[model samples]
Structure formats: C-alpha cells, structure tokens
Target: MQIVIAEDSVLLRAGLTGLLADAGHDVVAAVGDADALIEVVERHRPDLCVTDVRMPPTHTDDGLRAARQIRERWPEVGILVLSQYVEERYATELLATDTTGLGYLLKDRIADVADFVAAVDRVGSGGTALDPEVVSQLLARSRRRDPLERLSPREREVLGLMAEGRTNTAIARQLVVSDGAVEKHISNIFTKLDLPPTDGDHRRVLAVLRWLEGLEP
Candidate 1:
C-alpha cells in the first residue's frame, strides 16, 4: 500500500517510515506539518495516510484538522490518526460522518507491529480500527443516559468488541464462545440499542458508531 505520514517529531516520523517500509509498504511522503501533509497527499493521492493528532505551529489538533479536511476533499483516501492521549472530542469529530476507511489508534499501539500493520490494512480496506483504550474512554466519559442500560453484561461486551472493529469469529475466540453465540449476542445488542438490522461489517460498525455518538457531550 502507498502511504503518506505526517508527524512533527522527527524521531517518531523516522520510526514510522521505517516501520511501514519494513512491512513492504511504500512511504510516498513523510512530512512534518499538516500543511505539508495536505500538499503531499493531494500530489500523491496515496492509498492511506498515517498522521499524528498534533503537529507544528499551534501544536494542537492540526493533524486531526488535516485528516478531517482530507476526508471531506478526498473521501476515497483512508486515514488513521495516532494520538498520545485519548481525546474523545477529536475522536467524535473524526467519526461523525461515514466511518468507512477511518481509524483512530493510540501511538503506544505501534509497539505491536503486527497489530498495527493489521490496523493499517483494515483502514485501507475501508474498515474501522479504533483503539480499545479509546473505546473504553468514550464509554467511561459518556454523559448521556445509558441507552446501553438495556443490554445484558455479555451483550455489552459484544458491543464493545464490535466497536473495537473485531469480527464475530475474533470476538468468539476472545470470549471463548461459539460463533453462533457471538452472533446471538450481537443480534440482542442491536435489538436493545434499537438499531435496525444491517448485513455488512461496515453497517454494523456504523450502528455502533451511532450508538456511541448518542452518548457524546
């Protein structure tokens, strides 16, 4: 996959470039600021962009703003944002629209190269790849009355895993249950959340996103 990277930290930028290159992906451009990121992306039109949440100048949300702009202007390009902290507000904004080809992962997750690479692949293929910590933070900070109150404990577990972009088979393995059981829990979760039936993984993710968005401040 062809990728463009945007990070103000020189060392981290070099690390990310090396990681992607070692994984056999092309690093079309690795830039330091959001403006350069936008320029390079427009010029290269790479398959994916990995960007930090903060960048040069203001050092606050520049990368995220750039990601949002990229989503608006070049909706076909995939975006995966990395952050040192879980900023629920930024995460919400990034996911407010269609979440296809979108991801938000914690920078620490890069330590697990295989998992990070899988996340990149997932986002490039138009799938969600939210950090589990981000999911937890969103759930914990939610101020809205629990729409999720109706779900059983197991069903809520299923929903959390769903929000983390786990497949039914993967969730089953994690929970030590059968795929049929996982599906049943998911079905119950949809009913409890009042989400209409959807056939694809993308729609399932959308349903979870809608549920989470309802809990936002």
Candidate 2:
C-alpha cells in the first residue's frame, strides 16, 4: 500500500514512517503540516494517509480540516487520524459523510504495532477503524432524552462494538453470544434508533453516526 503521513512532531513522523516501511508498505511522503499534506497527497495520490489531528499554524484541528477536504476531493484515498485525546466533535464531523475508508485512532495505539498495522490495512481496504476510547466517550456523553436511551444495556454493548468497527462475527465473539443473537440485537438497535434498513456494510457506520450526531450541541 502507498501511504502519506502528516505530523508536526519530527520524532513521531519518522517513527511512523519507519514502522509502516518495516511492515512492507510504501511511505510515499512524510510532511509536517496540513498544507504540505494536501499538496503531497494531491501530488502522489497515495492509497492511505495517516495524519495527526493537530498541526502547524494555530495547532488546533488543522490536520482534521485537511483530512475532511481530502476526503471531499479525493474520495478514493483512505484516511486514519491519530490523536492524543478523544475529540468526539471532530470524529463525529469526519464520519458525518461517507464512512468508507475512514479511521480515528489514538496515538497510544501505536505501541501495539500489529493492531495499528491491522487498522491501517482495514481502513485502506475501505473499512472503519474507530478507537475504542472514541466510542466510550461518545457513549458516555449521549443525552438521556435521545433515542439511544431506548436501547437495552445489551443492545448498547452491541452498538458500541459496532461503532468500534467490529463485524457481526467479531461482536458475537466479544459478547460471547451466538451470531443470530448479535444480529437480533443489531436489528433491535436499528429499529429503536429509527435508522432505515440499508443493505451494506455502511449500515453499521450510519447507525453509529446517527447516534453520535444526536450527542452534538
């Protein structure tokens, strides 16, 4: 896979470049700021872009803004954002549109090299890879008056795992339930959330996005 990296920290940028290269992937460009990231991405058109959520100038959401723009212009390229903290607002915004080829992971996840690489591969292949922390924060902040309150505790658990980009089989395994049980729970969740039935992988993403959007101010 061809990848472009955008990070203001010199040490972390070099570290990520070396890590991905060691994993048998090509690092096409490593840039410091969002502007350079946009330029490099447009020039190389890499398969994936790994970027920090904060960069240069004001040092607040620059990388995330660039990521949204890239997704708008070059919808084909995958994006995985690394953040030091869980920014639910930004995550919600990034996922508001098409959820394909999207990921938002914590920088601490880099310590788990294998998992990080797997997340990159997953997002690059047009899948979601949201950090567990992101899901937890979003769930914790959900308003009591929202439709999410209609779900049972078990259904909420299933929805959380789904938001973390887990497949039905994976969710079943994690919850120690049968695949049919997981499917039923998901069906209940969708009905309770009032999400229209969709026949695609995006239904899970859309359901999660609907829940997240409700938490926004």
Candidate 1 per-residue C-alpha lDDT over 86-128 given as tens digits, one digit per residue, 9 for 90 to 100: 9999998898889999999999999999999999999988899
* Tens digits of lDDT, candidate 2, 6-88: 99999999999999999999999999999999999999999999999999977999999999999999999999999999998
Off by over 4 Å in 2: 144-217
Worst 10 residues of 1 by lDDT: 198-207
* All candidates: TM-score: 0.67, 0.67
Best by lDDT: 2
- Model 1 Cα displacement at 53 (Å)? 0.6
lDDT score of model 1? 0.90
Candidate 1 regions off by >4 Å?
144-217
